[model samples]
Target: MASFLSAFSMFGMSSLGYRTGFGALFVLSVNLVPLGALWYYMHRKTFVLGRARSWMSMGMPFGERYGNGMRAVIPVVVLLASIPYLVAQVQGIGLMVEALSEKAIPYHMGMFFVPVFISLYLIMGGMKGAAWVNTVQGIFFSIMVFILFFAVMAKNGGFAPTMQMVFDTHPELFQLGAKGGKLWSYPMVFGFAAAMCLGCICFPQPYMHAYSSRTVKGFKTMLLSFGGICLVIITMPTLVGIAATVIVPGLKGVQADKVYGIVASMALPDWLAALAVAGGFTAAMSTVNGLVFGNATNLANDLLKLMVPHVGQKGLVSAARWSVAVIMAICVVIAWNPNTPVAELSVLAFGTVAVTIFPLWGAYFWKRSTAAGAMASTIVGFGINIVMFIWGGKNMVLFPSAKLFQLNGFLAAFIAAGLVFFIVCLVTKPGKIEQKSLALFFHPALDGKLDHNLVDRSENEYVKV
Candidate 1:
């Protein structure tokens, strides 16, 4: 669960930091509003437990339940989408190392080192080891952020003076683009929020954490604490990024991803600079390990089993370890090329989750949501995003235009899938056996009891077991 929190915190800091400095209050609200709702929903409804049970009962604890067809669709999309996401984290480590060491350590070396460290703990300890490390790293990251924020503000004449300076220098930065400003347009801001909320729900790292927690209560506690911590980490860095825009003033040629490193190296002392470097590594490793583990599990449990059901548990675990190594190697190769910006790369993962899995899972639990609806929504939503990505790459249209069209993709997919599921359920109707199976899986009264019968039978037999 801590690893899950770190994943959200890392991306939240990287992508949302740009909007932070100008309108601290407004940006904070924008980021926290959806988080607050998620937290509340988790608390009041025991959302994690319900979700976990649903997945597990469906013979797909790792997301195999939407049928073989759906399973085939989701895991491949995740693996593909996650490549750029993982590479961006690798790039972050390299960029930080270069900024702090004055190019003493080559960028390739830093990139290589991150994945090696991640693979070590992940291969040795699996999810358990990753969570323990993430907990410690998350604590260190939080402290470093507060220290950096206070130091930067003190050096720049405190909060009030800093804001005044920012306003004088880059007044447009403060506007939310809703009211004639440009840092974030109204549609973009809302789209981002929607994507993030859906991403949190569907993301593999968070789902893994939800599964690993000792209890439902523990998971809920982690979510609330982690959400609060995420808000602080993100807001502070954004402020720092804005301050850099003012202080550095000559950071034009450099990439936006380098904003944090540049500010940390130039503004802070040697020790503080080292701490910032450590903090960045903490963020990078925490996210990397989680993603590696997520992909590994999907391979071990979903893809591998589908092809080779006879593979023993020990063999499965070994395969998962190797999968992590292979995935890490691929990510390293991609990171070296560096085709995408850090912000864009991170958003790509979120966008994929929002469009693909969110609607599918949403409808699975909602009475109004049908399997067909979920499936349709996923196909259309993902297709639209792909087209938009291609178009955007060619400089034919901006993301906002792509998103406007993508919205229809999501809507059409959701409606189409939902309608199909409803129609199917009504027309070919479930037999008593099927109803019994659905009731046992979906509304089983037992809190923690294992439905051994459900797990023991073959996939087809279990549907009526």
Candidate 2:
């Protein structure tokens, strides 16, 4: 459920769809493919294996292919990727709060206040607290927003009239090429879709939550429900964008980000608008708590374990709680500026983590995968992604209409990562294959005949067996 929210910020999605038109829909559709792959992969793991595959304790699963260096590197990437994603959620709260309060609260205060509230519960209950909060928030977010979505439609004389207005006003939104001043190209649309899809599953927060599931049956059920929720959440915002284009035309530049706020404030009653704000608040808060929990635990368990092994469980838990507060503070500081668009910042976070996909796939499925290949891929993919981002703000081109480098950072980073991972793996020495771990991936289901050795296996420490 948290992963569902993480994939698309509420205001961010509406703005992107409003700004880019049908191109946003293409990205949203393709984004679900990776979740299906994630479900299949996790479902195949031995039920007992679920408990041990966290970023901190990933040695058993990744040790055979990635070795210690890459295993250690995963959490760092997760931590970095998580921070920006957290900031996007914090920024979402700021946008909604400012909108809800008529700009009296201000963005920085809203960002600061939301995280403090979130940190209190996160420090108190850890993952259990996050899960309960997610359940309540997820329900509130979907129901109240669904109400707002339909109300917005009705106010504009229903979906048909709203869309007809958009088609008549912004015809390029429905067409393929750069009609109606649309910026997204065909390749750009599909490429970003692939990146979003791949990035969604590779993100560590969702990956971290996978370990908490108790049964494969439960996991599959959750995946199904998640897919349904994603469709509903994504669809609502896209429709909201289209409706906003009709209701409040000429929302240009950063003003597009205010579509959700504008719509809720204009169409809904006072109580309904307040409910919409609460729903958006819950959505952002739930996601932020989950990310802080994941990053804090990674620091306490994965990074510090090698440096401070003397810290016992109680000490580690204390460290985790402290890390939560510290990380939330850092996010508030970063969010104060709010430089990038919420959706773009979210895709940036996803792209940063998507680079790991090639190495991860190689580790899980390929017998000849090498540690050198995985490490090289991780470094190059992320390095190029960062460089391209600094150099090219959005289009990855210095000047507008520069045809030489038209690719978005997300697609470019993903392709570069995959190519490097493949070529390096082929040339480097084949990594040692742990038959014990290999057996689980190679024969995940075991045709319903379970192997107690694989199912019951547990690792107390990181050992390069």
Candidate 3:
């Protein structure tokens, strides 16, 4: 996920930072909100269920607690929302490739090469392969980000002078509500932050990582470390974005997306600039590995196995590998000539699917939550965003925390979905399956007790709720 801060985010954040100034940092504030919620509730709810303990893949808890509608639809909603984001990352790589090669390779051809390599490894090693590659990628990009930061700052003389230049020309950009709400306002930032936290629940990649954990302590430690990594990764890009205002100004629309590359080529030596492009490519491909694998895992483990009951283990493995190829093809085609800015696609994806949080939250935190409610809210929330996407046409206000009348479309979806979820959950009651599932989750001692889907070859016994 640290790669999330690289490539597309670097490209997107720099562009967004040019527009929003410091307000772009709000994107990294998930630790403050969701960490507290998890500590108080979700950890107790099913934290232990992750340790080689279940047949439940992706949002299986929802299926167990609610019904098959959630099992079928949640993954679909996630990958649909995720494809735009996958396209964003792929496009970021394509742009960097074209730039570094000075158009020797061309954008159309450059984009196809990396996903092929990523899909190859993921087919052979699966999640373990993706993990090892990301560990190396996370380290490389993290260092490159700070180097790019200093390279940009040094070009403008130094840190103090960089801020002074901006302050002298456009002091207003320093404020969170820069551009008089054309870019970002306080309400917009708050809404986007909420949307991201909620979206994390719907996103399959994080949940997939959890299943790798052997203990609660290890998981919590890993989660906490990500906050520090986020601060380091996010801070430099914001500075670089702000620095670009002076280094390369008057850029608008998709032109702004190139600021990260343009500024790098102008400031650094040719060799270093080439390395920066490689950094972007590494960052992008690392995330491509996860996004493709996560979606395929959901399709194979969560969706396919349910649909094809007679399929053996070998069949499931083949389905997962094949599904990765199909997903990569679809995303690459969409990415070929994307007009929307990279970061815009990413955050929009996050905000749109964020509405599913209503049902997701209700599942773990509220006993009254019913399957009917989860199904209704997921579809309705996603539908509301689709309508706004169409209505907004070419100029979407919800991108980069831009909002109108202090109401972001993401926030609007949240309200509509939350209202629908609460109403339906109140009107309905649990069935036999739901009751059994609820008993399993609500139980103090989950593993080796209740109705768990344990592998039966586990090691760590549950500490008991």
Candidate 4:
């Protein structure tokens, strides 16, 4: 849960819920299927060796088959993905604090100086420290939000009554694809659903978390537990957003981002509400810290290390620290004057990282997967995403007759990348696979059984061309 769920998720879910109540659940339930399926495959890829194999080591698999191409491109995409999320977190803090303080604390005040704290902890303590902070924050936020949900439920005369009231007054909020709804309309749903699904599937942090499992059984347990926890965490805020519709009503535009804090203040006691506020801050902080460190490692291990392959561990550490400062500074500056809503920012992050999906998965499944195709897919996907983000904002493509049938940047970019990936793979010649190139991913034990030991297996691995 701590791996990816953050203020980005909480604020985004609430805003979605506020706009369209049960529509938020509809989106999550639809998107989470792909996210969970991909996560499972990614888990098998990393843990097949019976050890954690992502993070600093994840590049090894791609590096072996795809060589320096993947090492060069993946880091940039990962960096791009992290920025939107970092901006979302800072935006979350600013929105929540401003709402909680009743605007005595300005929005910028909440955003300002956050990067400083992230830089300090990440530069000094690294990802371990970030993970610890995320764990602690995730636990606290999870508990408080669960308690806060029922509190709001009781105060609002229970879930069914709230729904009855809303239906009586504003039925559009719960309609999944109502035409006149501000955000829950079909066009909007298509875009956000793509964003949420890709975002959930492609974020780098969860892949790293997959590496922590020491055993297959333990890994399954972790995934199952994570799935359940995600349902709870996601449900609480979504319902809170629904409850906000009744309690506060009439919030328009980006104002819906503050629904979480407003509802907490209305439902909980003064002391608990304050704790809830603190929980919100911690949620934002945890995600920021994690992204900061994640970006730092991406710079040091994947990008920088390739350029200077001989750098020792000490030099890498220094480079990662420097990367933290630089990256955090950039994110803070952008967050300071964000033009995008927190929900949109989070969606953009998902679309950015998702560019790598074809480049990554093709290596394991497709025999014709080539480095050129991988690199081209990365560039094409990223380029299309940038184009659509800037030029395709609220612009729909295809099925010109009906607005509801159009596709958004997130889905369009992903599809374009995959198409290019397949074309490039067919046109280009693939490198040798029957060697030590994929010993780790294609262990000999994988033939009919499982083995934890490192097997010198490559000649017969993934060779069906």
Write model 3 residue lDDT over 1-465, tens digit each, in one string. 553554555787787788667767765564234543443244334445555346336657668778777888888988898887788887877776676677898988888877788889889888888889888887787777788889999987999999899888777677766355445566767766676556655566666656666556665666666546566676787789888898888977766777788888988888887777566667778877887788887787778878997888898789889989998899899987868877778767777777777776676667777888888888988888888788885235374323555577767777888888889878887677667666555543443431223322222333232
Best by lDDT: 3
Candidate 1: stretches off by over 4 Å: 1-28, 36-65, 178-181, 252-254, 357-364, 367-371, 394-398, 402-437, 444-465
Tens-digit per-residue lDDT, 1-465, candidate 2: 753574245778888878878767767766764566564564344233445444334333455345567767877776787777788778777876776788898877777767789889998877887889989898888887788889888997998988898899988777755445556666666666666666666665555555776555675666656655686677787788877887878877555766787788888998888888677778778878777777777677766765786889998899888898888888888888766767777777777778887776775567677788888998888888778768766556111233435556666677788898889888887645433446544544334433344444432211212
Cα lDDT for residue 463, candidate 4: 38
State residue 228's C-alpha deviation in candidate 2, in Å: 3.6
Off by over 4 Å in 3: 26-46, 178-182, 394-405, 446-465
lDDT minimum window of 10 residues, candidate 4: 395-404
Question: Any idea what lDDT model 4 has?
Answer: 0.70
Model 1: number of backbone collisions: 5
Q: List the residue pairs that clash in candidate 1.
A: 372-417, 373-417, 373-418, 377-413, 377-414
* Candidate 3 all-Cα RMSD: 3.9
lDDT of 4 by residue, 1-465 (tens): 766677766777887788767867776766664565567665556555424233464455567668877877777777887787788887778888898988999988877646777788877777678878788888988887778788888886887787687777777766756455345656556566667666565665655665555555666666656655676688778877877787888887577888888888898888998887677677777877766776677678877788998999999899989988888778778877656667667777877677787866776666667888888988998888787656646333211114224566667778889999999988988776413445545544455432333222322233321
Put down candidate 1 lDDT per residue, 331-400, tens digits, no spaces: 8888886555565566566656555544344433433333444455566666655665675461221245
RMSD to the true structure for each prediction, in A, is 5.3, 3.6, 3.9, 3.7
Identify the superior model by TM-score, candidate 1 or candidate 4: 4
What TM-score fits each model? 0.82, 0.89, 0.90, 0.89
| Stronger candidate by TM-score (2 vs 4) | 4
Instruction: Give the Å error, residue 203, model 3.
Output: 0.9
